[model samples]
Each structure stands twice: as structure tokens, then as C-alpha cells.
Target chain A: MARKQGSHSDITGPRVRDAALRLIARHGYAAVSMRQIASEVGIQAGALYNYTPDKQTLLFDLMRGHMADLLAALEAADLQGDSLSRLEGFTRFHIRFHLPRPDQVFVSYMELRNLSDENFAAVEAMRRTYEDALESILRAGEAEGVFAVPDPRITTMALIAMLTGISNWYRAGGRLESDKIEAIYWDMVRRAVTA
Target chain B: MARKQGSHSDITGPRVRDAALRLIARHGYAAVSMRQIASEVGIQAGALYNYTPDKQTLLFDLMRGHMADLLAALEAADLQGDSLSRLEGFTRFHIRFHLPRPDQVFVSYMELRNLSDENFAAVEAMRRTYEDALESILRAGEAEGVFAVPDPRITTMALIAMLTGISNWYRAGGRLESDKIEAIYWDMVRRAVTA
Candidate 1:
């Protein structure tokens, strides 16, 4: 499964990143230290340097990986047609992508404070790329006369916000299954867009 | 403007809370300290205690007051309507309430970890109350056959998520005016459920 990046380090890197995610999610990123992340990973603070060069790098790696993974997942999903259909696909893909690994989502949202100025701008650019993708779909739908919206850009942000909110409240043992949760969001997304 | 419930201590309490919020919003809550807040307030850290008992109290107080203020604002808007009107009122009210105080919104979202168990529960309860109110409006709309939603609870959450995301990105000098922002959201919310 490993490429130029060794499976050993790739796998171990995520492990450390996961620990940092949970720590930063539970305690704000500003309060976390490299020593604390190292302790969480069952290694000496000095050992963490093997996986990541420094604290900011670790945070950047996690966020960049997360944004990349999300966009890749969206691209991988074979979704097309009207605005409503694309939105349904998005809702389903988003729930599947985010709900399973909530700590990662929480980390990505809250740990932006840890990124250096240059890194933050880069990640934010990626984040906007995803939003623009959604808007592109909505705009196409409007052009095709399949969906009607006063403002496609605002709708895109609204839809994302609505979909991601699922992570804040969804629980593994909850009454609804993940697929069911996806379906629920898809229903709203479709309704929100249908002409 | 201060009420009788306000004392010298009470007068300073809000100043101390505001300083804490600005710092916590700029830096995460865990990284912020009572002494920092005192310094920002231009008062001694010891005087800061006289306003708030401790750091935890200050965090919780800011969050709780935020939630309380949010609910009160919604209640006060009292904008009359059928289900759609009520929801629009909520959308407008939420945007207006959040615009003036981005830092409070930031703290409410980012500082939940700092809240003590009792404090967290209280804020959580109030949040649910606001959510439940919205959910009930959806239910009423469903009953009246004026709105269509697959799940009232999920729809409620989706709307709240979309509304809150505004605070994350909206800027004072942005191309979109605040009223335009509100109208854009209102269009989405209106189309999302109206039958």
C-alpha cells in the first residue's frame, strides 16, 4: 500500500496525527505541545520528530491530508445530473467521508490556529476550491434549468455547513445508521435545490 | 445603561469577559489565561478574579451568556409568521445577532472544552432548546402542508449549521453586504422546504 512514502512511516504518521487530532480536538491546538502529542503516541517527545519535523508541520500535514482526502473522495464519487442529484451525491459522500472520523473533522476545524501563516493560506485555498466545486455544480444546474437559486455561491456554503453539522451530533451507536444519516441529509439538500 | 443587578463587580465582569473572548477567539481558549485577560482589560489579574471566580468560570460565563443571548434574541425578534415566516425570522435574527459579535460566536464554538461539566450541560440544554424550537416550527410546517422535509430534527440541524457558517467567513468589507448575505440565505432557506 506504500509508495515513495514507506508504509511503515505512512501508517505510523497517521497514528501520531490521530493522537494529535484527538488532543487538539479535546483541548484547543494552542494549548497542545509536541511533548503532549508524543506522550499520546506512546513515544518520547524527541521521537515524534521522525514522523514530522515540527509541531506546525504535523498540524499542516493533518489538515492538508484531510482536505485532499475529502476532495479526492468527492471526485471519486460518480455523481451527475441535475443540481439536486449532485447535491444528494455530495450529502452522501460528505457524511460517509466525515462522520466516521469525527476527531479528524474536529481537528481540522479547530486546529487551524496551529498552522503557520503561509500554511494556513494554502489550506484555506484548498478549502475554497471545494466550495467552488460545489458552486460550479449548482451554477450548472441553474444554467440547465434544473435548479433555481437566487445565489449559487451562498447556497454552496449553506449546503456544506448543513452537511458538516452532522459530525457535531452523529454518534456510532445512535438510532440512525450512517447510510441513513446520509439519506437524511440528501433529502434536505435535494429539497433545498429543486426548482 | 447598567441595571441594578449590576455592581462594580458586575460592571467589570462584562469587560473581563469581553477581553477573554477576544483573546480566545484570536488564540484558542486553552492557550489563553486569566492573567492575559486581565492584562488585556488593563486591570490586575487579582481584580479579574473579583469579576470572575476563575478561568473556567470566565470561559463558561462567556459561552453561557452567548447561548442565553442567542435564545433571547430569537425570542425577542417575535417576527410573526406561518412556519416559513418564523424560519425566515430565525435566519435573519441569527445573522444579525452573530454579525455584531464574531468573537462571541468563536468562543461559543471553540471553548466548549473549557466548560465544566455543569456549565457544559447548561449551555448544551439551552442550545437544544433553541434547536427544538426550530424543529417544532418545521413540524408545524409539515403539518400545515406548507413545507416538505424528510426529517424535522435533521433539517433543523442543517439550517443551524448553514446559519452558523456565516460567522466563519463573512467579513465587514466583503463584496457582499450583510443584508445581501441575509437575503441570499433567506432564498436558500425559503426554497429548501417550501412546498
Candidate 2:
């Protein structure tokens, strides 16, 4: 790691990915082309090939990165209590992680269509893994007699949509800060599923 | 009475819209060109201008038609009872009405970026009107002390997302029928919001 650190190759990869993320977020996954992305990064269109083989790979990379970031945030949060605290932590972490990067969130959700079938399966698997984590929390709450949801699947979808919808509508230049928006979303998700 | 006949104009407006909807649904709005839609409709590219002045207009026309259909479905449903019945009726109607037109549903959710400002504003207004109707139901339920919601606006987004998510994944040839899917969704929405 020490030998290769801070070399020209090291910086190019992240720069290319950042430019691709912004373009894909703004223009949608399908609409952005390699030429557009390379231009944004101050490189020739052919240079992008060095970092990622194709546009689909770039989108897959960004979304995969976001999902891992999300799960990491949840893990880092110190929730040391009952199921409710876990639920609260999950909701807050989700909204907070997603809201700041609307482009990433939009790309992650909207660009799934452009991924190759194999790439898509991998991305969706990671996403489903996160969802299962949330489901387990709900199931544990139910077993502990703290949650009384009729169906965990529906509750989970509803809660996620409630949180993700905030990202669709949340704007940094707008009135509400990200924390307030997260709190508002958390309130709705908690009430919708809480016993 | 003498003029009670169909408009057999060579450029059938509805037919063109249907073709564009399917094309845009398969390829995104930006990928779709007016010539492609005209070709799909079995007409010369130049002739398409008679129906829609431009591609954006065509996109707007399809979306407006979908919104009109949605609102009409909502209005025609029996809302004679309390807020709960009204909300249930909406969920059922939404699933039934949208399932058959998944392409339109996809276009409705995904094509807003393609519309001009005026058309986008019109679509947004129609969407808000529908949401407002749901908000009214939530308000009524809250007044009756039956629904436990922290925020009507947030709850409305969740309910819509939960129901709309069905179209994203539902297949026409699946084991479940549209009615059953609607019923399952109604069950989910009913339990999630109502006490």
C-alpha cells in the first residue's frame, strides 16, 4: 500500500468515479454516455476504460459503493438497547446516509435498469441483504412482544419508501436541513411499524 | 346525432400515444425519438408532427393521459363511507388501474425529467391533487381518532410507495392476479395506518 500510495494512478480512479456518479445522477443512468463522463473528468473518452470497462460497470460500482457505505454507517452507530433503539438507529442512519447524496441515491435506485443481468443480480443481492437485516430487527421486536405488525415485509417496504421518499424531495438549498428531514422521516417509519 | 362517429383521422392520436408509451417504457424517454414512435405506429416520420409537434409534447401527452385516467379512476370509485373506506378504495383502484398499464406507470414515474417545465408542472399538480385526496382521508381518520399517524404527508408518501412498488416488480403472468395483489396491498396499507 505504501509503495503505490499518492501516485497518479491512485487519484485517477476516484476522480473518474466521482465524475461518473455526478453525471449519472443528473442525467440518469441511461442518458449519460462515456464521452460525457470523460469530458467531465478532464480526460479523453478512451481514458475512462482504464478505470472501468463500461458504463454499466461504473453505475454498478457507484451503487455497490453506496450500499456498503450505508451498512457501514448502521454498524458504526452505537445502538445499545431494545428493538426500538435499533429501529430508530436504522431509520436515522438510512435517511442520513442517503439524503446528502441525492445523485447517488437517484443513481442507485433509478440506474438499476441499465446494469447487465449479472451485475444487477449482484447489486440487488447486496440490497436484499440490507433489507433482511431490517427485517430481522422487526422480527426480533415482534418476538420480544414490542412490535405488533401484521406483516413485516409490507412494514419494511413502507418504512423504506417513507425514508427514501425524503431523498427524492430533499434539497440542500431548500428550507429543511438533512437532520430535520431525517427526523421527520424517522418519525413516520417508527409510527408506521411500532407497537 | 349525425356526427356521432369516431375520429378516423389518419393520424390516430391515441394510437400514437400508445406506441410512444411502450417505446419509452422499454427505452427511456430520452432514448426514444419521434421517428421511432412514428415508425412503430406504421407512419412516416414527418407525419408524426401532425399528432405531436415534438417529442416532448408527445411525452407530455402520454403522461397527461395516464394522470387523467388515474384521477378519473379515483373519482369514479365509491367514496361514500368514512375515511378508511375511501383510502381502501383508492389502494384497490390504484393497483387495479395501474397493473394493466405498467408501461404507463413506469413512464409516469420515470419521464418527468423529459417534460418541459409547463407540462412537468401540470403533471405535478395532478399528482398533488391525488395525494391531497389521500391526505384528506388521513385527516378524517385522525379526526375520528382511528388512524395513528405522526404526519399525514409522510404517511401518504409511504402508502403510495408501497402500492406503486407493486408495479415495479409485478409480472402479468405471475401466479397472483391483479385483484389479489390489490387486496394484499390494501391489507398492508390498512394495517399500517389504521389503529
Candidate 3:
């Protein structure tokens, strides 16, 4: 059946995705069923099919959408200026972008094994593209003699992992303010990359 | 039922833990069943109870065992010398210990949500002790003016996360040798903390 613009699908589509992300994050993709997701969304089990064909597609969609949003946000951040400035920007941007989305971060990383090989490749390629963004900054800094990157690829992964790990323990009203956290991490990132 | 030492229970215990680790790492604790675990161990479902009281205990055991092993190994590393030396030792030791046990690392981090409140606290305490080992080094380095750490706790977590992230992608016979990988990570760890 052809549905009109912004119909039930449009309204329930986001609800479905949000519910799937929540359930999958809490119980893992392997254990979470589409029926559970539908129940969480206050819909009948069969109604879930209207939004996605199966649990796998729902999972793939959640991950793909997350990456797409991340890439879009990074593009919008428009990190500019010299390599050092851009590197700092990337460091802060990564933390700010990922810190609040703990569920998404958990589900995306934890549920990768559940994705089909083809889906896994797609998500991985998107991830690689994101990593390339940081590696490019490292390369630019290396070329400018501003950063002593012995291994740019490894440096990129290490820095990203370190920054992304904040989500594991950070709380909104924790001991440190977000700005202070960012500043501290920025210092380490700067010193690590530079001489 | 009394069992003799080095009998069937002793032999089957390790197999059960190994199978549980493998299955849980691949499918997650929420999705994996005791029956499947028993099947994987080539034992009857009922006999699986002889190994563990229930799945929660099994998961708690797996996680507790991983952290215990990590702590014991860290103690064995006997990191001595100046703060810098110990820090380098920690950087290398973390990578060496975690890289080869990807499954354990995966379950330890990913299955934290599935752990019971008491189990979670127990594991968290053990993990905290390990982090303390590194934080003490940073604290010492700060006192000696060898390192400039704005936040010792956050720094410890960040460095650990960066070093442990190697397990996510590092493979034996990969492009970089383990020794080379250790050296590269050590450089970042050193610069990231030092002035």
C-alpha cells in the first residue's frame, strides 16, 4: 500500500528506530526480538514489519543511521584552521558528539557481530571514512611538521579510542565539567601528537 | 554429590568456562542459553548444573575470572623503577596482556550491563584496582614533575582505553609486529602524560 507523505510510517518510523536502539542496547541485538521492539514502541508485533522487514534490517538501519548522523555532524562541525587547530576541534567534537549517546555507542560497537557480513562491511566502510577524517588531519600536521606522527593510522585509532571511551563512565553532573574534560583531553591529544 | 579432586568435575569445569566464554563473546550473554552452552561442551543440559548453579553465576564467574586473571597478571608484571619506567611498563603490559585475549576483553567490557548489581560492583572494584596501579604511577610522576596530569583518574582511564583498544583490531601476523605495536603505543602514552 502506498502511503502519503508524513503518514503513520513517518510518525512511527522514528519511534521504531528509537525503541529498537534502546532495546538492542539494553538486551543486545541477538537477544532482542522484533516483537519486543514493537511492544516497546506500543505497536503490534506484526506492525513492526511496516517499518522494517526483520530484526537484522532494523539493526542495520540503526547502525547506518547512527554513522550517517555522525558523518553529517562532523561535516557540519567544519573543522577549519591549521592542522593543530583542526586536531583539537576533532578531539572535542568527537567527545561532545559521542558522550551523550551512550546507548548508541554501546549498541553500535557491541552489536557489530550480529550484523551480516555485507552489512558489517557497509558499517565498517562508514567507520573507516570517519577515521580517515582524523588520519587526514594527522597527515596534514605531519606534512606541516607540526605533529610528529610515527604511525598516523595507529595514532588516529588510539586517539579516537581514548576520546570515545568517555562515554563509558561520564555522567552529566560528574566531578568534572564537560569543558574541563575537553581541555584535559585536548592537552593530552596535543602533547601526544606534537613533540 | 561429593567429587574427587582431578575427577570429571575438575576436567569439565575448564571446558564449561571456555565454551561459555566463546559463546557469550560471539552471541552475547543475553542471547546465549545454558542448553547451547552445554551443547557446545558436549554435555547434557542437566549435567551443566554440576558446573554452575545458573547462567547468572556463569556470567559472573566469567567476568570475575577475567578481571582476576588481569589483576594477577598485572601483579606478576612487577612494574618497578621511576614513574616513567612504570608507565611504559603499564603501556606495554596492557597491550601484551589484552591483545591475545580478544574474547575475554570483549565479554569483560561488553557484558558489564548484564552483570548483577553485586557482581558489577565486585568486577568494578577489581577493575578499579587495576586502574589504580596506573594512577599511582601517574600520581608519582606528577609529584616528581615528570608528568603533567590535569586529572589523574581520567588520564588513567583514557590511557587504558587507548592501550586496550588494540584488541579490537590487532591480529597476529598483521602488518605491524607485536613488539612494534607496543613501542608505538608506548610513545603515545609517554607523550600524552609527560610535559
Candidate 4:
């Protein structure tokens, strides 16, 4: 009986998160209810408590999960070569990583205001770590004389915003393929920072 | 009686819009309700119908007003000088214009999915026109051999994304002043496309 219950949780947990993400992405976190999320997941509303304590916790978990996933993926990318090559690698990886997860990207930015202050600070710390990765690359580039960034911190924010903004308009079968888009962006990014 | 009614509307109209923008920006359009907006405006819920037919229309009107205002302001900006200088003018204008209206900027992007099909198309057309203004500058620069933009349209999107992103983190008394921020961004923009 215990094994069966554990197996049920394994399937239900992911389904709960998936439903919550879709609902919250379509409607704001404040508008979506646990009942609706449970309905979407084909579970009883009471059963949701088994997976999450409350809506805020669920929101925090989704956001925390996204940031953790981002950091993990970036670490696994194992960026190599000089700063120039690493910058290119980072640029392409950002586009590729974010393009497939539009809902996560949308919710991550849009629902940030809904997070509790402590949750916000926690999420922000993770985000800063990600930004610092790129800043380190820029600092290295500046030292190597391959780049001439005036302000690495501001430049990091600008470049991330530029790259993430792609999720707003990009479609799979659109006018330009993702590779083409990546190449164009990489060229612009390269030119923007290079001496 | 007619004069009194007109005067009342003149006051109420803006209050309603201001309330809607704040609520919708904070909670998102889908999450916000007509009753809440009416409360925010210090009016009866039923009276909201007298001003706008429905929540969707209210959302549409706010979005339309924002775009219209943006276009009119751009037109009145009357940017002069060469393409490079005009680009500088645009960069500064965009940052300054959007910084104070973070709510409008937030709603404009976040609530696009909530807009009706026709409303979405209408907003997109206005947005395209704005993009065209920047594209024209890039084209002129390329034609004059001053810029090396391989794709003017993509470059226009990238530049706008980078500029508008200032709204995300900018504050009134932050570390850097707006003017300093503008100059730094302008330098990056100039380097990005110059030959």
C-alpha cells in the first residue's frame, strides 16, 4: 500500500505542477485558483494540499525550480574557449534554453511581483548568480582586451533582456529559423561589446 | 445638466484609466475585475459600464491609448540630424518615456495575451509602426555606409528590446542617473551598428 501511494505521488506531483504553470501563465497567479489547477490536473482540490501547502508556496516553487533549472543547465553547458567564444556560447545558449520554455519565461518575469518578500529575495539571489556568470566572462574579456565593456553589470542586464525578449515574438515556423536568429543576434552582440 | 455631466466624465474618465492601469499592472488584466476597478476609481460597479462596455474594452482602450500616446509623442519629438544622431534621440526618448510609466509598459507586454483578436491585431499594427520608425533609421544608416546592420528589421527589434528593458530595473534614485544610463546605452547602440 505504501509503494502504491508513493507511485501515485510521483505521477500526480508533476501533473499538478504542469497544470499550475499553464493556468498561471494564461491567467495571472492572483487570478488562478487551486481548484482550477486541480481540475486541470484531474485531482481533487483537497489533494492539492498534499503536493503544495498553498498557492504562494506553489508559485515560489515554480519560480525557484525555473531558476535552479537555468543554473543547472548553464553549468552543464560547460562553456569553454576564450572570453569571446564563451560570450558567443552564452548568447546562443540563452536563446536556445529560453525559446522552448515560453511559459516559464513569461511567468518568471510577470509573476515576480506576486512573490513574498522573502521568496523574492531568494529568487533574486539565484538570478544574480546567473548574471554574475556572464559578468565574469565580460570581466575576463575586458582583461584580455578582447572586449571593451564600460560596465559589466549593466551590460549583463541589457544583454540578458535582449536575449530573453526573443520569447515574445519568436515562433517555430516563423520567417527565420532559430539558428538564423541566433546567428544574427550573436553578430550584433559581438559587435556591441568588441573594441 | 449636460455641462455638469460632461465635466464629471472628464474627471471620471482619467480616474478610471489610472485605476485600471494600476490594478491591471499589479494583478494583471485577467486577474483584475470590473468591481475592483470601480472601487479603485471610487465609483459604483454599475457605473463602470457607463464608461466602458466591458473589461475587455477597458483593457483595449487603455492599451490603445498607450500606443496612440506613444506614437503622438514620437511624432512630436521631431527628431532631426543624421541617422546616428536620430538614433540617439530615439534611444533617450524611449528610456525617458517608458521609465515613469512602468505600469503601462508592464501591461502593454504582459496583457497582450488577454486582448481580443481584433484588439491584438490593432495593437500589433501600432507596434509595427513604431518599429518601422527605428528600421528607417537603420536602413538610412546602412544605405549611407555608416552602419553595417545585416538585417535592419532584426536590429530594430534588438535595439528597442535593449532600450525598453531599462524600465525593468531603473529607479528614480538608483545608483546611476537616467542621463548617465542613457549615455552608456547610446554608446553601446552606436558601436553596435557602426561600420
Candidate 5:
């Protein structure tokens, strides 16, 4: 039974998350049911509990996982060099990282009101950490005399919103490719922050 | 009977929209029912039909009403002068206009997926009209050699997204006042497009 449970966990866990993400993105966290999610995953309703305790946990897990993945990807990107270069890296990295995960991005933003106070704080903290990473780069550039950011915090929020907004409208077979879009946004970001 | 119907329609129409907006903003469109909306507005479930044909129409009306108000407000702002000055006016106008209408802003963006195809097209057309206003400003600046926007359409999206994002985080009384925040954002906008 233990071995069987482990095997199911390995394959079914991601499927459950994917299904939940899709449903929540479409219908929202308040509307989706455990039964619908289990059906989406092609599992019995009773068996769905084995994977997640409840709908709230599933939401918390999806949000937490998205932020964790974002932080991990940022670390893996290993942005290096001077603050300007790092800022550019951050710009391109943000666009690339978020474009493919529209559902996650939508759920992360739209479902915040649905998160329990404790869960909301956890997600908010992770978000702050991500924002701080960019804020640090802006501060470093300010110190290095290359950037003229009057308020690093405000600038951080502005830049992130501008970058993340790409996911809202981008489609794969669009007129401008991702690389071109990145270049245009990077140019704007570079100009917006330069001394 | 007609006089009585007109009286109720006069008072209840706005109430129904207001109730639907609040409920949909809080619980999302799929989760919010006509019965819940009626309960919110202190009306009977069947009475909601007097205000809207169905739930879809209510959602469409709320979204359409929000966009209509936005376009009307933009026109009222009557942004005048050179391209650069117009851009500044637009920036300040966007932040001020949206900050007080957070629920409208939230519902306008989040409930797009819930709109029917015909309703979606109607809303999208209004949205494009709004976007065109900004794109025209950018293009004028580009022509006058005051701005270096490579793509006016994309720049419009980026700037609007960055500006609308303020509604997401701004509270009633924060560390920065509205005018100060406007200055900071306007500064960034000015610098970003300056040739």
C-alpha cells in the first residue's frame, strides 16, 4: 500500500495541480469544487483527498509553488555583472519566465483575495522577496552612479507590473516574436531607470 | 403600473449594477449568482430580471459600464498641449481616475474571461478605443522627434499596464500621497519615451 501510494503521488500530484490551475484560472478559486478537480484529473472524488487536504490547500499549494518556481528560476538564471547588466537580465528573465505560465500568473493575482490570511501572508512574503531582488539591483545601480531611481520600491513595483503585464496579452503566433518584444521592453526599462 | 415600473427601474437599475459589481469583484463571476446579487441589493431573485435580462447581461453591463465611464472620463480630462505634455496629463489622469475605482478596475480586467463572445467583442472595441488614444499620443511624440517609441502599440500597452497596476496596491492613506506618486510615475514615463 505504501509503494502504491508513493507511485500515485509521483504522477498524480502534478496532474492535480495542473487541473486545479486551469479550473481556477477559468472559473476562479471560489467557484471550483473538489469534485470537478477530481473529475478533471480522471480520479474518484474520494481519492482526490489523498493528494491534497482540501480546496484551500490546493490553492495555497498552487500559489506557493508558483512563487517557489519563480524564485528558483531567478536563482538559476544567475544574473551577473554590473547593476545595469543585471537589470537587463532581470527584464528579459521576467518576460520569459512569466509568458509561458499565464494560468499560474492569472491565478496568483486574481486568487489573492481568496487566500486565508495566513496563506495570503506567506504568498505576499514570497512576492516581496522577489520584488526585493529587483529593488536591490536598482539600489546597487543608484550607488554605482548609473541609475537615478528616486524611489527604489516604487520603481520596482512599476517595472514588475510593466513586465508581468506581457503575460496578459501575449500569444505564441503574434506579429512580434518574444525576442522582439523583450528588446522593446528592455529598451524601455533601460531608459526608464538610467541616470 | 407603468409609472410604478418606471419608479422602480429608476432606483433599482443602478442598485442592481452596484450589487453585481461588488459581488463579482469579491466572489468572481462564476461564483456569484443572481440570487446572491439580489440578496446583496435587497431585492428578490426574480426582480433582478427587471434590471438585467440575465446574469451574463449583468456581467456585461458592469464591464461595459466601467469601460464606458473610463472613456468618458478620459474625454473629460481633455488632455491638451504638445505630445510630451499630453503624455504627462495622460499618466496623471490614469492614476487618479483608476485609484478611486478599484472595484471597477478589478472587475474590468478579471471578468473579461466571463463575458460572452458578442459582449467580449463589444468590450474589446471600447478597450481598443482607449488604447488608440494613448497610441496616438505616442505616435505624435515619435513624429515630433520628442520620443523614441519603436512601437507605439506595444508602448501603449506597457505604459497603461504600469499605470493601472497602481490600483492593485494603492490604499486610501499610504506613505506617498496621490500627487507624489503621480510625480514619480510621470517622471519615469517622461524619461522612458524621451528621445
Candidate 6:
């Protein structure tokens, strides 16, 4: 079939992803169906197939997209300066990046089990890449005698988990602003790693 | 119907909760159906209701049970000694306790959104009690000039999040034994709060 100019695909593509992310985050990936996603997008059930082959692919795409965006943002964050400053930057960046995207964060962590083996590996690799960014900072700090981490790998996972945990309880217009939360977490991260 | 001794209900009650937990952890609570849970327990669909009135009650029971068991175990831990020792006790205990129950930890955190408001409040209150135990340690440590926690509440949440996070990646027969992992985490936790 010949494609028309300004086709619905371009317009509906983002809506499909958004609806799928919201629904999957709310009800989980296995329970959500194509019809439900399509309805959420205000499209026909069969039309969803035009965007993705199946629910699995749709899920894989959403996850991969999130990771890809995260990595790209990390690169753009231009984390520079001494190891301490770099670690601080990374801590603040992680909280800011994840706090607003509660749905993405929840779906990314919770729905990994539902991904196919191949998809799971791809997502895991991206996650490892992100963790490596922090691990390198710890390694650098250790070499500089600025930090005394017993295990950089373990510390990497611990810090990431701690920072990401904020998404679970933080809300907008709360007692602490994002910057205040970031500063408090940065202090703990610094103390946890420093000699 | 009159109750029968050693009836299927007696045998199937635990099986139902076990199957429900496993299924809910794997596929999420919103996705698992009563029939599926019953089938997993090798029982008929109608008979499933004999164990629990509905899925909401089943979920509430599972969550409440997890919290109750957690609180009871915390009391049994009988953490003692100076504030610093108590803090170490908590750091190690949290990791050891959660590592063996990854499914429960995962479901408890991930399924909070699926819980009804009343059920969620009950679970939250129980969680607060657990957090309070840790907060008291921090408070005592700070008062004794042993720990320099800027905000005890925030530190409590951060430490608990960090310790509980071990379950996300730790596997039995992995590179590090539970004791080793606990030691590494205790070191970090100690560093994170010490003066």
C-alpha cells in the first residue's frame, strides 16, 4: 500500500507508546492487551499492529527506548571535573531524570521479567552500561585516594539503588524540593564512598 | 457447608497463598486470575473462594501477612548493644532477611500501586513501624555523638532502601556469600552514617 503524506502513523506512534507505558505501568505488561492499548490510544485494535508486530515487541521497544534515552541523556549530561564532582553530578542527574518519570521507572524495573530472554538481555546490557558509568567514577576516586570503596561493583549497585529508590516515595510539592533531596543524597553518597 | 477435618481446604489454603504469591510476583497481581491461582493449587475455581473471598482480600492478606511477619521477625532479631552496634545489627539483618525472600520484596514494593487505598494505608503503617526501628537507631547514634546523620528520617529511608536493594541482584551460590555481601554493605552503611 502506498503511504499518504502526514499519515496517522507518525501522529499515533507516540500516543501508542505513551498509552502503552501508562497502561503497562498501571496494570502490568501481561495483563494489558493490544485492544486495551489501542482503546487507550483511541485507535482500532488492528491498527496497533501497524505500529508494532505484537505486544512483546511493543514492550521491548518501550524498554529499549527508555534505556537508549537514558544513555543518551547521560552522555549529554557532560559529567566532568574531579571524581567527586562527577559523582555528585551523576547523583543529581539520576534523581532529576527518574523522579518525574515514575511510570517509566516503575515499568522499566517491574516489567523486565515479562520481556523475552533476548529483550531482557538487551535491557540488562543497557542497565550495566549505566552502572558502569558510576563504577568508573568510583574507580577513579579510589585511584586518586579520595574514596575507599571496598567493592566498586557493589557500591555502584548500592548507590544506584539508593538514588532510584527516591522515585518510590518522592512527590511534587513535597516538603523537600528536588534540589534539596539531591543535596541530601549527594552528601550520603559522598560519605559512603570517601575515605 | 460443614467443615471436614483434613479436607482440601486445609491442604490447599497454604498452597493457594503460595501459588498466588508466585504467580503475582512473576505476572503481577493485576494479571493473575483466581482460576489460574486455583489451577496452580490443583483445585477447582469455586473452591478457591473457600480460601479467600476475593482477589482483593487475597492480595491484602498477602501484603498484610508479609508486613506482620516482617514486624514479628524484627522483634525476634532483638537487636542490642550500643547505638553503633545496633546500627550494624540492622544493616546486616536487613540484607540477610530480604535476600532469601526476593519474590516477597519485589511484590511488596512493585504491587503497592495495585493495593486498595485502605489496604495501602495499612501496609504503609506497617512499613512505617519497620522504618521507625531503624530511625530509632539513627536517633540514638546521633544523640550519642557516634553518628552524624543530618536527617535521621532521610537516612533511615536511604539505608533501608540500600540494604533492601540487595535482593534485586544477589543470587544464591553467586560470587559472594550472603555473609560477605552483608559485610560489604555494613561497611558502607557504617561509613554513610558515622561521625
Query: Who wins the lDDT comparison?
Result: 5
lDDT (Cα, tens digit) per residue for candidate 2, span B1-195: 445356544337778988999888877887778888989989899988888889888888889988988889888885768888888887887778777887887778777877889999999999999989899899899889888776687677767776777765678887667776666567667766776
What lDDT, from 0 to 1, does candidate 5 have?
Answer: 0.94
DockQ top scorer: 3
Q: Model 6 chain A: which ten-residue window has the lowest total lDDT?
A: A1-10
lDDT per residue as tens, model 2, A1-195: 896899767989999889988877666666789999999988999888988998877888898888888777777885557898899888887777777877786777777778889988988888888888788888989889888766676566656765676765667878767776667566655655666
Candidate 4, which segments miss by more than 4 Å at Cα?
Answer: A1-6, B1-6
Measured with C-alpha atoms, the lDDT of residue A177 in candidate 2 is: 70
Least accurate 10 contiguous residues by lDDT in model 2 chain B: B2-11
Q: Where does model 2 exceed 4 Å of error?
A: A78-80, A173-177, B1-11, B148-150, B173-184, B191-195
Pairs of residues at least 3 apart in sequence or in different chains that clash in candidate 1: none
Evaluated at residue A50, the lDDT of candidate 3 is: 87
Tens digits of per-residue lDDT for model 4, A136-178: 9999999999999989888998999889988888888989899
User: Model 3 chain A: which ten-residue window has the lowest total lDDT?
Assistant: A1-10
Report DockQ per prediction, comma-separated. 0.74, 0.38, 0.85, 0.75, 0.83, 0.77
- Model 3 regions more than 4 Å off: A1-6, B1-5
lDDT per residue (tens digit) for residues A53-135 in model 3: 99999899999999999999999999999999999999999999998899999988889999999999999999999999999
Candidate 1 lDDT at A16 equals 94
**TM-score: the better of candidates 5 and 6:** 5
Tell me the interface RMSD of model 2, in angstroms. 2.9
**What does candidate 6's lDDT look like per residue over B42-101, in tens digits?**
889998999999999999898899989999988999999999999998887788788999
Clashing pairs in 3: none
Q: Tens digit of lDDT per residue, candidate 5, span B1-195?
A: 678766968888898888888899999999999999999899899988888889999889888888899899999999999999999989999999899999999999998999999999999999999999999999999999999999999999999999999987899899899999999999999998999
Query: Each model's fnat?
Result: 0.83, 0.18, 0.80, 0.63, 0.72, 0.70
Better of 2 and 6 by lDDT: 6
Deviation from native of the Cα of residue A34 in model 2, angstroms: 1.4
- Compute the lDDT of residue B80 as modeled in candidate 6: 98
User: Which pairs clash in the backbone of model 2?
Assistant: none
